[model samples]
Target chain A: MEKTIGNKTVNVSEDGYLIDLNEWDKDVATAIAQEEGITLADDHWKVIEYLQNQHKNDVPLTIRSVGKSGVVDIKGFYALFPEGPLKKASRISGIPKPVSCI
Target chain B: MTKNIVILGAGTAGTMMSNHLRRALDKDWKITIIDQRTEHHYQPGYLFVPFGVYGPEDIVKPIEKFIPDGVNLKLGAIDKIYPEKDKVVMVSGEEFDYDILIVATGTDIAPEETEGMMGPHWQKDVFDFYTLEGSSALAKKFRDWEGGKLVINIVEMPIKCPVAPLEFAFLANAFFEQKGMRDKVDIVFATPMSGAFTKPKATEKLDYLLNEKNIEIVPDFNVMAVDGEAKTIMDYGGKEVSYDVLVTVPTNKGSDLMERSRIGDELNYIPTDRATLQTKVKENIFAIGDATNIPASKAGSVAHFEGEVLLENVLNYIQGKDLKEGFDGHANCFIETGHGKALLIDFNYTHEPVSGTFPFPGVGPLNLLKESRMNHMGKMAFKWIYWNMLITGRHLPFVTTKMQEAGKNFD
Candidate 1:
């Protein structure tokens, strides 16, 4: 499915994660973050950049890893994204949601 | 010159690979599997231990029982792997060189990662069911449990058998019902996931099950610490959920060997090619199951599914052929919805679990994503299959390494 975020249209999943990261940009991220009641600040972008960088390297994301990434602590991560930090960060970063399906 | 195919961990994935490759490799090519643990446990049975559906005797067996005759089973702690040197160093000061290395070093619960988890009430009111000792201890604790607020909390994601906690909640409901104390117990399932199940359609169905069983779902709760003295789990967001007895699935990580070797990720899981099961560490090195940072579920079934792809990849690596991107992350699991019923979910990397017929297209032996007695039977029957067929590297009849989408209702 395609969703219009800010001035750009991008593919998204039913859960609203960006289907293709190539279509992601700052405007799109701000638009997605806006839906979650989060305004992208410098710290949020740092987390988003960290998440995108991790996704690029194929390292599976987790709150524990994000906390240990030296980008932010767990409490700081929650404070940045509020609730569901990993999912929110992934969404704004335009990466697949980090999940364990067993 | 004699060559070696060294395997780490004699658990499900390692043992199965050892059996699968031993007969195929030439006599000159030696296969040695190493693990510190002596017993091979049927890990799925751990979910039933706390409920007494299965006993300690049922799930455990000697590791030596599964190793094929030609393969050598080295029982010792592996200190590190020098991938560049093609060597494995044991903690006891012994070293073994290998032509190829297979790391099936499965994950384990790290309760100490969470503050106060291993504190004063370690195995008393606060318990973990991932380990044999944990499950057995939990069973003993449940013997005279009068039932109050029983919270089953998962501290983090990527835990082994992702659905086991939900199964625990469902079984707890059934357990209390059988004891004629269902109403006396308030069941709470606290997880980091957004819902009872991760998949959408499955969540829709499972959410109904949770409601029907009266199990409370507490989503988006990431544990910062276990307040053992207060009997509460404190999330990073400052959400506190109190419990009379808490069964938590703590942070799970790859083998310590990976940590010692400095070849693993932050969680000590080896970064691997998701499709090929080949590790990023080295060309000759491959990782499978819970040990690798594959997005797939860290369950025996995932390892079982990956075995076919990984086996082919190893053979390919030996033959100097290009590796096939054959693995599709196929995972099949039975969700115990309690009342002697369960839901069987069959899915892959690209597909979510949908309602359909399994093994057979339209003919009805087992149903997917729908609760049935047959699915529960399939789950129970899996134990025998695990012991007899799975560990022996034989394929189950009608099941394929890749998921069959013919009978499934997609959309």
Candidate 2:
């Protein structure tokens, strides 16, 4: 399924996770953040930036790696993304769902 | 006339009962088991998944492999049950009449029952290690993850494997130490109980372990909500626990089929007579394992013990004899304390886990309420025992279904 996020038409799974990574942009991130009941703060942006950078560099984004990234501490990462930090951060950053998640 | 024995579910209790009944009953009795899925999971192994002790493939096998030749295995969802008529209806519109019915469909983690539990963060930062998929997902999450405040919380009690969360904390401590970053991880154990565990004797030993490991124990915490945005879990009393990553043992409930069949409690667990393992709902119906509302630990060991009691009582009921009120709520648990050491606790309805040796009075190789390498080996050996001896209805030489007080230390 596809939904219009801001000005971009991005593909999403039935569960509302982003399906197409290529279709994601800054506007899409803002839209996802809005849906998740979060306003993108600087700390949130740092996680999204780190996640997008890791995806671009072909690095696997895990909670441990994210904690070790030095961009934010593990607790800070949770505060930034709230409910599911890794999932929401990745979604807002416009990446395909992580393989390890259910 | 052929008498039919219909067993619902093909899990540990159901599978073991099926095997036992097939051997004990004569050829005139036709045995049939109904399950929605074909694969059976070693649920206890799920606790080891996040720590990478066991993989998904190592714990799962075909249900048909354990089932005997004479038993009929039916694959279909349960639609409804008519206890009054001694019949069961499947979702596919198939029906089966039974002279005796045993319900052992078991319980599952219901994450959605908690508010904000299955939100966007689900499978991301907040995860459970109870199910095969959940544990596998957590295994990936734990890999290369520098830890922060790792909160292991139980939403409520009476869950399967009561000792598992404590085991997880111990294993995670070991896991991080192996990664050489044990100092970086702050582990917190938040529970609804007043202490580290339910039984007093076991609680004292476990509390010391937690204190020695520098892991915080937040007891009597009734979780009300998970504020994903704030990254904190709020309790009923307005206390909050923040987490870097949250590992939860969600609320466990009986199979949905139980409620549809009008044979279960509010939680869908069937009402069963404590001693006999027979359903209080009907004379011909019986319930066992995690599916029943018995005051027993919902562990595989308890199920195995119940299987022993059930086999005898079910047979007696079939022959119109007095049912044996022999089940003693026997449960044995192994607490994995990491570093190649573990603890074993054996208890039943009346007794709490105490300090001493197990099975053998003065010559036991296993220690109770104390950490030992022997206990660890015994814990690891149980997987093989479960597949080979326990489910096959083979009697274990040393242990009995009833709790023996000879070896246990009360003073």
lDDT string for model 2 (B316-380, tens) is 99779999999998999999999999999999987989988888986788998899999999999
Docking class of 2: incorrect
Where is model 1 more than 4 Å wrong at Cα?
Answer: A7-10, A100-102
> Model 2: residues >4 Å from true position, as ranges?
A1-102
Q: Candidate 2: give the clashing pairs.
A: A64-B145, A64-B146, A82-B228, A84-B121
lDDT of 1 by residue, B243-352 (tens): 99999899998888887899998888999999999999999999988999988888888899899999899999999999999999899999998888999999888899
Least lDDT summed over 10 consecutive residues: which range in candidate 2 chain B?
B220-229
Candidate 2 lands at a TM-score of 0.80
Report how far off residue B291 is in candidate 1 (Å): 0.9
